[model samples]
Target: MSSLSEIITSSLQKYNDRPAIWVDDCVYTYGDLSYYINQIRNVLHQQLTSPALKGERICIWAYRSIDAYVGILSGVLSGMPYVPLNPRFPDERNLSIINRVRPKAIIVDKNCEDAASKILPTIKFPLLVFFPSYTQKPKWCSLIKQHQFFSQEELISYPLASISNLEVGSVVNTDSSDMLYILFTSGSTGEPKGVVVSHGNVFSYVNGINTISDCHYDDRYLQHIDLTFDLSAHDMYCSWCSGASLYVTPHNLILFPNRFISEYKINKCMLVPSTAGVIQGHNLLFPNSMPSLKYTFFCGEPLTGSVVNGWQKSAPSSIIYNVYGPTEATIAFTYYKCTGDSVDRCLPIGKPLINQQVIITSSSETAADEIGEILLGGSQVALGYWENEKMTDEKFYSHSGKRWYKTGDLGKLDPNSQDIIFLGRSDRQIKVRGFRVELGEIESVIRKIAKTYFVAVLGDSDSEYENVLGGEGYLNVVALVANSQESKENIIEECKKILPDYMVPSQVIFLKEFPRNSNDKIDYKEITKIYYKNKNSSSISAHNNVI
Candidate 1:
């Protein structure tokens, strides 16, 4: 068993001159990466003297560039847990995260200096900030220089200090059970929670995937997901461990899917369902556009059958895989191969990966025969939420030497095929006229009938219903969002083909785009708020008519 540090060191030795990471036209070979990491390590050693600083929290605010990768690896090599902030994040959001983590230092790219400076004025913590630039020193750079806040050029040009050499120990010390990284959840609902993943947790999950997938040295992987998101974990570590070339597609190119894939010769890629929806909505195909792609992985949100059908039609030869997992369980715990027939049916999340065990537990915490919460027990389970003891105790529990994490998702074991069928969220289940309903079920049915890019179902509160039993009754409300401008009557008529009368949404709202979080997942809470706000202003009534 080797640590992450050992894996990187060995890869550099084996593929010294090989292209290790490609960002735009700038290529960083193994040798170049090794030297840069070493330089960064030396700078860290000079700045941090306290023991806590050895693995203290470090924040990085930068775009997808070579410096971003180097900054991350430098923190790992220096034994510090690092957090990455998307450069596009608003200043307030960025500051909120910074205050929560209270990092010892921050690494900023030159392009983001303006935002960084705005934050620095209000921040009291002593920060060591480094920026990458090729031009002459700017005014802010001179100001910081005068104040001795430290600059990148000074660190890079300074003589290397001679100190006791720190062996490239595991990037994470397994014995310590310490956190290796803190990835914050996309705050779509409210405040984002920081998930603390241990070194052992990451190792077990990555190792399992590496063995099953046979990810090898000859493979060239295209990294499309944001580093802030979990899907990038599979792309980063799997490629790093296998000594494969990692080509990072620029943010601009990612929007133009066909050209991005063809130009990079992307053989393997992972994307969110929203991205797949975009491709399908545009009526794009691979052979005519992105012929180089051989395999693609889709997850993050539910992949509709319609989306899968379009993908298969476009690249029939490409292996389409659907992976599912929460951040609490490393990157992914289950994967399914999507075939033609499988796409027509509800896409099963498939079985658990090697060494991971999953079971459907009822509300009473007893093993159930059918629908229940998805409970996972395996080496891949993370340590717990960071600085959140109450949540840690609730989510993580030990039973007979094994620990299980409650996934908070509803799923059922199929009686015939014995596969797991994902139902909607248990907490999201609502009661309409004493009938239980899952919003996901209604949303899934609506997707098949409409040529929509996205859809979300929420309980409505506008329609009034009279109680026949007691001369008074409570009214049930329902609302939905469709990514098209089709008439409300047309949509309700189409929805009738798949959904039952009670399950069909009472009102349909059309939007050109759905509000999304940083991870590209829909902001359901926000959508519901908007839905109710509109319902309060309109005099909508529920009648026997479809409209």
Candidate 2:
């Protein structure tokens, strides 16, 4: 299909009664989902009479809900791009995105109405659509009565029933090159940068993965990731386009992923490695706990062997894949199938996806088994950062007549296996005493020795106290470990055995948990704050002798 609207409409006709989405205690059939889409499309039309709204961005407060899904699909169906603002984000961050995109309208579900209400007034003449949940209302629901509210029951009854009778086409035919959505990633310039992805970019990705994987009509795919994360785009569209069911994990059960999978009998899933690590850290995996799980796809972070091995032992029938890609290259374009017995105890990110090309570049040449910046050339590489020409020109470049996105990640092809082994981010590489160090390499060694999935190694040799601590800088390696049984000194000694003296962490800190950010990944900034606060403490000084 050329457009997601076409994909949805086609699925509606084919699987009319089949369950399309399962959230909480509700199961919405394809017909039910399509009906709501039509009603929402009509609702959007009634409110968005301004022709200027067409082709502009419509920001949606994305969360786990039937309305949240319909709102995005509906906006795309209305021939406008959608910007998903996670309700969990701070008002300032959301406001920054709003100001940057300058969306014509905003859509919010009941869970986010309070947050959206406070933000909507900041924009001029902004049209708002509020989708109230059948289960509950926001705490401030009673205070605001002027906004338009559409509940599931209200959308299915009376005037909406008439909406079904009206010969209106829900699918709006736009050029496949049109921007479908813009997802903002943390920018190096303090302000977030919006990654512009066209319908063609996503269409190629969904079709490419489906062609190789077992994502078919019979599978019930789980949607546990937050919608704002680009991985959710893969979760929703991949399952929907294949006519499979998409199950949203309950907020209460997100922390307990094993239960979510077993209870839902999910056959397919895609999630970050950290979520799996959480399950492994808790020893939550029981024998055959998730027998129904078939295809397990992991991305957004490095997939470690111990985590996947433990997971593999529990779900013996499943095939675990390590999928890797950046937001600029659509959801993910590289595919790596983990065999559980991977060398170096870490899974290779593997080759490129179908209709995509992966090359490692150093200086002016691309070669195998060479450590260099990874470049992606394919249909999946994005249009560039939204409205930022200078930034776009810097990352997205035309090489040999094909547009290639320069993934700042450092990786090299295995001379023997030809698979890509990701090193780490090129920009994140730091120098210690004139020696280059990759934080991920240190974290990798920590994960292997600690037998734990969550590990973060932070260091900076250019701090103010550098003159006193060491030659250039402090040269301090602060290893933040989670759920590891090894003592701080033992962990430091283990690193000293395998890693060089300079690479060994000057201090090792143990925590029951590592603080996580909005993306549910380890919050390095928070850890940095804690690190600095304790840098001068006597307790840390006692452990400095280990270095």
Best by lDDT: 2
lDDT of 1 by residue, 21-87 (tens): 8886787887777776666666666678534466588787876777677777777666677788766
What's the number of clashes in each of the models?
3, 0
| TM-scores of all candidate predictions against the true structure | 0.75, 0.76
| Cα lDDT listed for each candidate | 0.66, 0.73
Candidate 2 per-residue C-alpha lDDT over 228-323 given as tens digits, one digit per residue, 9 for 90 to 100: 678888878888788899999887776677788887788888876656765665677787899998989988766677668777877878888988
- Sequence-dependent TM-score of model 1: 0.75
